[model samples]
Target: MSIGERIKAKRKQSKLTQTELGKLVNVSSQVISNWERGYSDPNHDDVARLAVELDCSTEYLHGISGDKLSSKDVLVAGQEINLTTEELQLFNELKKHPVMFHDLASDPEKKVKELLKMYKMKKMFLEDDEELGDGFGDLED
Candidate 1:
């Protein structure tokens, strides 16, 4: 699919109208419509914002890669942080939660730490549950 198609698909998948997405990107709905219609493209900053809002990599949005979640390590604060696709999806879900909506703006580092902790805890719980076999085998009558 083309970039415009990708953007439109992602926007719809995200359940955001063009006007809402434009507001988030600080542009008018007409601009978003233009982008969806392939009449114009967003600038670099807007593209980055769109990627974040869409919970996808810029490469996916740009149609350079078919993968919505990259498998490679990401650079943050000059450090390479490796994460699996599931972990990345968890992180994205956490970042989009209402409780975390303002955390990034107030303190991104703290938010990252918190998200990492949550991800680890979640992974551990899932592992433990799997080991327990249906998570109800230990229940007593």
Candidate 2:
């Protein structure tokens, strides 16, 4: 499915309106609408945010691959987030390949999408800054 379709699906599953998601991701509601309609594509920053927020990867957002990480994999990757004990237990039970978890507190689909957006945004932002330099590179010249 397209990113727009994926976003709409996740948003509905999470019970969040486009405006709500836009607020969380620091975008306008219209921006979300535009993205969902394919009227515009998200910039790298937005894509990153969306991926983390969606708990997928930029590649997944771009539809490069449809393989989603299992809940345990998501939890493992999210170790730094300091998930709750319940969350950890849930992940532990769900981490094996062909992953499945019963009674997840959060909808895995939406949770993964959101997490992916945050992860992608953070990684992309840092990479972009590094590539652009600190803007003080010529200060000594």
CA-lDDT, candidates in order: 0.77, 0.67
lDDT, candidate 2, 38-81, per-residue tens:
88888899888877776666666778768544333443232323
lDDT of 2 at 60: 67
Scored against the true structure, residue 49 in model 1 reaches a CA lDDT of 92
In Å, residue 109's CA in model 2 sits off its true spot by: 24
How far residue 38's Cα lies from its native spot in candidate 1, in Å, is 0.3
Top-TM-score structure, candidate number:
1
Error of 1 at 118 (Å): 16
Q: What is the lDDT of residue 62 in candidate 2?
A: 78
Runs in model 2 deviating more than 4 A are: 74-141
Best by lDDT: 1
Please provide, for model 1 over 1-141, each residue's C-alpha lDDT reduced to its tens digit, 9 standing for 90 to 100: 878888999999999999999999899999999999999888889989999898788878888768786444453443445666765667667756666435355545556667878778988999998888975566668
The stretch of ten residues in a row with the least summed lDDT in candidate 2 is: 71-80
Error of 2 at 58 (Å): 2.2
